[model samples]
Target chain A: MKKRCWRILAVVFWLLLWQTAAMAVNQRILLVSPLETLQALFSLLQTAAFYQSVAGSLLRILAGFFAGLVLGVGLAALAKIYMPLREMLFPVMSAVKATPVASFVILALIWIPSKNLSIFMAFLMVLPLIYSNFLEGLNRADAQLLEMAKVFRMSAFNRIRGIYWPAAFPYLLTAMRLSLGMCWKAGIAAEVIAQPKNSIGSALHRAKVFFSTPELFAWTLAIILLSVTLEKCMLHLVNRLGRGLENAR
Target chain B: MRVERLCKAFEGKPVLTDCSFSFPTGETTAVLGPSGRGKTTLVKLMLGLLRPDAGTIDPEGAKTFAAVFQEDRLMEHLSARKNLRLAVSTPDQQISEALTALGLPARDETPVSQYSGGMRRRVAIARAVLADADVLILDEPFKGLDPAAREVAANFILSHCPRAVRILVTHDGAEKSLMQVKNVLDLGMAKEA
Candidate 1:
């Protein structure tokens, strides 16, 4: 309870400082107070178009995240089983990790429709991170346990559930936590560039063009809230899955 | 099972050189040695977890092997019952019986990670015994157990694996008599080249 009080106090302090700064500037177009931002957000919440934008962005980004997750896990398994595949993937993964998100967005924009651009960007952002972390986790599995599995002649399915899953779970969770935030940020950036008709990014773009500083701040706040909420939900789900795997007989 | 002229080395330092022994079926063969005597190397070779620099381990038609390794290699996140189920397709009744015989709580949901050292060791042993393999390898299987628990574990193993070619790897000479091991291969006396 003490910690909660301190946190609330700290947020209020920051908001007051921002309000004072906005008043000093005396220019609403350049800087909006926290109150104005919240008011703008409340107005956005009242609109059907705002809901559509939120839904559209959420669906595309989450779709990309799930797709990246599945592919990353599958590819990591394949790489673990086959050495040549790991060798083949190493350079490609390195390149993907090194490449700029904007370069990909610009290149992808030419090939795909604006509505699909964020999906591709989000997937691209998430894939390498999940792949590397999961592969590292698999590589870190206990050698002694693996030998025990071999001696027992455990089936592949049993080996994965009993041995591999436990080893890789923490790394996968870390990947998910990291990639969730990145995917959202990259997805929004792609949407901003691609100008998808009904997306939070396009809404943000519109707010900026019309000199609606409060609306811009409101949209930015919404993105942060959504990112944090989604990340927490995903991590909780992953932890539950880990528990299920552990309890599986 | 038979090992003929088995040799193994690590980093060019010889651990076992031209060692041979026959492990009789339906009986326990104890491999006795101090640390660094290649007792584990021999066990690994027989289980095909390691390659002998030179060797031919004849299983004598045995297809399946189970082991309680030096480390209790239980999936740490899983309960004792789940660990057993991973290797053995045996029913819950048999699993519970095995756990009970080994002095572990048969229906406990606690993961082996939270168990005491001796409890984890028993889980590893139970997993091996329940596997019902053609060859059962027990590598210091009772390391962490008290004398009474050790006796119970030994008896459980002996009774369950009656038909298996059992190989007991231990430096402790008392284990040979405890497990009723008739054939003894003392690697301490063998020359390491």
Candidate 2:
């Protein structure tokens, strides 16, 4: 705990130096002091608009993430069962993976409303990763166990539960970890470009437009806090789910 | 029952050609053969897990079959008892009795992964035997155990279902004698290298 505190203190010390440098430069357009950023953050926290913006972005992004997870897993399952389906999915997954997030956001803007654009962008960012990882996992399931199940004439359900699920879980978990982060980053970027009403991105955009550097920094800090907290919560949920499965066994 | 004109090929290469045999009822038969000589294939064909390019498998009334694979194909997460229960709906008492006889002391709660190799082998054997089936196919069942453990397993098999049709596949001639195999189907002595 002491070592961790020291490391944190070192980070604070660097931020203080940055604050001093920004003040000495006296250029609010270029850089904002840590004190000003903190003051802006505290001031923003007192307003209902801040909460509304945070909540709006959170709901939309999470919606997209959930949708992607479901669709990706379903497609992966289909891809595993049918060769033609897998072949068909290959090019589509590649397209999604290869395309730039900004390109996707821009293209999506013409098709979807600005309010929903971030959600769609987040879905596009997450889908291919989940699908590819799950497909690879299903493909790499233990052949020996499968053969054994075959010899025993295990039911389809039993084979899936006993063999396929176990093999695919680790890969699925890894994909979830990676995809969640991507979704957040991409979703926020999409929101910033789309400038959706009642969103953190919109507030950030407003701050930038007004040259309120401290407000910008405050909102940026809020984004970082949300990202870190959400990632930790997701990891905790995944670990808890794993433990529950272990206990069920 | 008979396996008549049994022939199988992988890709372009043929493994068993025009192979014929009769597996007698109410008797234990050992299919003794060297590795890669279609012994496992023969077991699979009998179980209908594999198809023969040209052959007929005339199975008797024993449509239901239970098998101990060459590898102990067990659910790593589930306990020995749970694994057995999944395959067969036998009572806990019966499973316990069988497991104890096979020298698995802590039977019910320990997952197969936690068990040692010998213990896992015993669980697999117990699972196969406890399953309500007329035919039992064991593929190299006693590969990893010491002599004493093998004896215990053999005794458990003998006591559990004395009248079932047993097909034991192994490369060891000594295993044939140890299991008191009535008939030996030496696939090695059959035609083709």
Candidate 3:
């Protein structure tokens, strides 16, 4: 409780500082007060446009996140089962890791429509993290437990559920915690470049063009709020799933 | 199971060389050895977890196996009963009963991560004893137990272990009688006074 109070106080302190600096500047185009930002946010929430933009962006980002998760886990499994496939993927994996997100966004824009760019970018950001960590976690399987499982003549499915899941779950959780935030950031960035009609990124672009600093702050706040909320939900699910599986075994 | 001319070495050091033994049905065979005498290597070879440098282990029509490795290999994330329950075809009540017989918590709510060394060893014991298998291999299964507790564990093994051949790797001479072992293979004969 004390920690939560401290966090709230810290947020209030920063907002006060921002408000003071905005008043000092006295230029609406240059700065926006916290009060003005909040007012802008409230007014934006009253519009159908706000909900349409939020829903569209939320759907696009979530689609990308889920797609990345499935492909990441599936590819990790395939790579583990087939070493030749892993070898084939090495160069591409390295390229994805080394290349900047902006480069991929721009490059992808040429190959696919702007509406599809967020999916590609989010998948790009998440794939290597899940792939490498999962492989590492799989490698870290407890030898003693594995030997015990073998002696018991456990079937392959049981072996995975009982032995491997406990070993590999932390990696999965880590990948998710990292990638969910990444997918949103990359997804929004993709939208800014692509200018999809009903998107937070397109709204942000318009706010920039109009010099509506308060509107820009409101949208930025919305992005942060959504990111944190999604993170909490995802991590809660990960922890519960991990404990449930461990207890089930 | 028949182990013939079984040889294994790590790097260049010879652990076991040309060791031959046939485990008989309806009996317990104790392989008595001190540390560094290839006892564990032998157990691993028998369990087919490691490839022997040379030789063979013929199952002799025995289809299934259960074992307690030197390390208490219970899943640390699971409760003691859950670990035992995962390994066998027995009902959950029977699993708890087996744990109870060995003086372990029947419905332990705590994960095995919090278990004492002796408690973990006992859980491993319960898992092996409760498994429905043709053969049992126990490597230093009584390592952390006191003499009194050792007798409880030994008795449980005798009563519950299948009549088919069971192999026990231990250093305790008293265990030979305590477990009512029918045959003893002293791997440390080279060092035994």
The lDDT-based order of candidates, best leading, equals 1, 2, 3
- Runs of candidate 1 with Cα error greater than 4 angstroms are A1-6
For each candidate in turn, the TM-score is 0.97, 0.91, 0.94
Comparing 1 with 3 on DockQ, the higher-scoring candidate is: 1
Tens-place lDDT digits, model 2, residues A144-221: 778767656777766776778778888989999999999998988898999998999899889999998889999999
Question: For residues B1-193, what per-residue lDDT tens digits would candidate 3 score against the true structure?
Answer: 8998888989898888888888887788999877888899888888888999999999999888888888888778788877766677688889878989999878778988998888888888888888857888888889988999899998898888648578988877787788778887777773343
Tens digit of lDDT per residue, candidate 3, span A135-196? 77776788888888888977776677677888888888898899889889999999999988
Task: Quote the positional error of residue B156 for candidate 3 in Å.
Answer: 1.3
Candidate 2 per-residue C-alpha lDDT over B117-137 given as tens digits, one digit per residue, 9 for 90 to 100: 988999889988888568889
Q: DockQ score for model 2, please?
A: 0.47
Better of 2 and 3 by DockQ: 3
TM-score of model 3's chain A? 0.93
Candidate 2: stretches off by over 4 Å: A1-24, A243-249, B91-93, B105-110
TM-score of chain B of each: 0.96, 0.95, 0.93
